[model samples]
Target: MNLSDLRQDDLGLGIGLRTVHFGHILENWPDIDWFEILSENFMHTGGRPMYILDQVAERYPIVMHGVSMNIGSKDPLDLEYMQELKVLRNRCKARFVSDHICWTGVDGTNLHDLLPIPYTEEALKVMAEKVKQVQDILEAPLTLENPSTYLEFAHSEMSEPEFLRQLANETGCGFLMDVNNVFVCASNHGFDAKEYLRQVPWDQVLQFHLAGHSTFETHKLDTHDGPVCDEVWELYRLAHELSGGRSTLMEWDADIPDFDAVHGEALKAREYRQSMSSTSSSLEND
Candidate 1:
């Protein structure tokens, strides 16, 4: 399948649609570009959550980011969940659907965590078939995000970017490149973060995820509980240039803050993009 067949578009700067800002959004109808909603939150709801979602969907562009697709599981694909996801997308008129590249569970038991997978030939083939199956079920390209891993498999064969690039080439799946995850994993695994960005399949990247992480004594964790740090922001600057710009979203899942603060943090992406444009103009004149 061709990259253009994915039908992904640049939606501009966005923020994750969290419950804390629902009332503010409903009342003010802020001038945000779009909102990325957790797909599972609305899939099984018929009460106030669904009502709030209906109102939000009418005003802003929605994209479904899920955590339960289990794309790499050994178990069979969950058809019932896939149907629910499709229905939610149709209801919200979501632009695209996304989930992590790692597996969530196996044997019909959900561990409720984004676990890492081995980057081997066998694993790659399994993921490719699962991605194609999901795309067919949803009738849209499935965008997968790179997870922040705490450990690496000893028997892994390739790097994360190489695996993702090959998967995209084989199955025509899009990617949600998380810049913070790159920085965190690089620190934990001792790889160069810039090199990781250089090897990504930029053509298949439909969006970028920017967030904050916490530093421990020995390693860093993907907390997403604070603002985007300078290091991660720098990586995002390079990613923005590499991808020629894409829809950027700020994720703050814990220690929740006010609506204005979260939205303001997301707006920092515009500053980074503008700086790149300014530098280019200066070089052209000189």
Candidate 2:
């Protein structure tokens, strides 16, 4: 397959590559089309993670998803980290690099959390510039995610989708459109998720994230702890229909189940996508 033609996947489903499923994957090499790996997991000099990464890359296509890009922070770019990532991408033949839009740390301190940024013009500009620097260093555009936020900024200039579009315009980067993040944000901020999805530039979407979330009395949290809810599944179906079925990934990070359970959830997504495609084709035939 011409790699560029692979906007999503033939199977329309992907399992988040975890260590627990590595052996099963290596042994059988299941029918999974692709896998997304945490960029930090394989950043080390040498270890089991790196070895497995090499094996997987050789077997199936892999994309790099990271936590510590820290694109929105005021601090300078992490050149050292980027260099290591570039090497990893080269070694593993990663399809693309992606990270959350929030900042991870400041003042040379790693907070180990994807912290939200204020929705101000200055903040947007800072993030766009950082994305540009990262792309230039890596000699390719990066993918930024719409994070699940708990708070909103008092001095915000634009909506979250507007911020994402502007960031893409400035940096010429693609997007990793996380449907669960938008759902969590909407439940927390009381905005319409469909409007957010409509306003986004769907053509530039490189990946689609589907994961589970938890709801509290005050708001919902994008915790990929369990199966994706019906609401999230509905939104994901809409997104895939809109984006022409981009790369779809099922993320169940915490309380991860055995290999069979994860694979089953992914297969369910593929079924949903196929059902939608059939409906669309029927309409056209009429």
Candidate 3:
């Protein structure tokens, strides 16, 4: 859980590791800061997937972003999955490990989605303790992300930002702030995105995620299927300025476009971050 000297860098931008990019990445090997892997994709592998995984690890740093921790679930920890994660982290030499800050399932069931957690002290305590234990067991500091939540609990006691800040303060963990998630949640919950950024513990934020989302008539969902929206771009600007432009990633999962097309989006994220830096310098000199 030692983050005092954790090295942070804005490696420009990187897209989610998809199969389409494997050959080009391995043969041509485009220059990238790193690749973020969906842990479950390679969870049961021994063929081409694992081979490409190792090759990519050799080329660029890989970060593990998972969805099945269920850290906030009422059920007990999944020790088997934890062991598997440790093995994968070692194999990939991931820079860090991360997962959504909510439950995935309960009662030995797999809901296959990132669900919400009540913002109560009890839930906070449950999540923090479990996270601390996970970190200790994994021998690495866990990075919990504020997921895109579609609903709220009636018994919630604190705001989303408060819950995230408390998680860092109470559990000695790091954060992967997803700018797209914040925008979606704010629109759904009707909170101010800029205000949310101001409340975040930026020092504890090690990385940032930028992704595209689709909008429903009622709310914006984190579908990550289309181009990054202009509105989310604005919110990303705020997050970059607030978090000092922490390491950013471009994520597109479903209906993934061509490899070059996805990486093209990542390049766009780097451009946005460059603008944020210039703006910061101007304001400081004033």
Candidate 4:
């Protein structure tokens, strides 16, 4: 699939639409570039949540991100879930739909976590076929995010970025590059975070996810609990330079703060973008 065939838009800076911020969003209609909604939240529901979503959709661009889709699982694809996803996408007119590169469940049971997949040629072939099937179902290009992993498969044949690059090359699916995930995985797995960014297929990256994580004695976690750390922001700056910028979103899912605080954290991306631009201009003048 041609890179240009993937439909993507630079939606500027955005934050995940959490329930805590609904009142502020509707009342003030804040100056956010866009809002990303968890696909499952509004999938089989109505009432206040759906109502607010409708209002938000009318005002701002919406993008659907899902924790399910379990694209790597051995279970057959869930046609019903994908249909609901398609319906919701049309209902809100979301720019595109995204999910993680990890599996969420197996054997009809949901683990309720983003489980890691082995980076191997066989997994790549299976994932590419599944991605193509999903895109066919949605009738739009599907974007997958890199998974933050604590452990690596001993039998794995390639790095995660290489696997993702091959997947996109084969399937025409875009990527939602989560910078925090890169940092977390790098810290836990002992890989160079910047090198991971360099290996990413930036041409297929449709959006970037920035979030905060927790540090533990053994490993770092993708908690999204607070503000982004300095290192992640530095990586994000490099990502913006590499991808020439894309629709960036701040994800704050746990210990959620007030809307203003979350939005404030998100706006930091603009500062980095400006810095990257200035550096590029200076280089050009040399």
TM-score list, all predictions:
0.96, 0.94, 0.95, 0.96
How well is each residue in 1-286 modelled by candidate 4, as lDDT tens digits? 2335543467889999999998898889999999999999999898899999999999999999999999998888889999999999999999879999989888999998999999989888888889999988877789999988989999999999899888987988899999999999999999999999999989899899999999999999999999999999999989999988889999999999999999999999999988877988999999
How high is the CA lDDT of each candidate model?
A: 0.91, 0.84, 0.86, 0.91
Ranking by TM-score: 4, 1, 3, 2
For model 3, name the residue pairs that clash.
none
Collision count of model 4? 0
lDDT of 1: 0.91
Judged by lDDT, which candidate is best? 4
The sequence of per-residue lDDT tens digits that candidate 1 reaches over residues 192-231 is 9999999998989988999999999999999999999999
lDDT of 2 by residue, 31-78 (tens): 888898999988865988888888888888888899998888999989
Runs of candidate 1 with Cα error greater than 4 angstroms are 5-8, 278-286
Model 4 is weakest, by summed lDDT over 10 consecutive residues, at 1-10
Task: Put the candidates in lDDT order, highest first.
Answer: 4, 1, 3, 2
lDDT of 1 at 148: 97
Give the per-residue lDDT digits (tens) of candidate 3, residues 158-190. 998889889888977889999899899999999
Give candidate 4 regions above 4 Å deviation. Answer: 1-8, 280-286
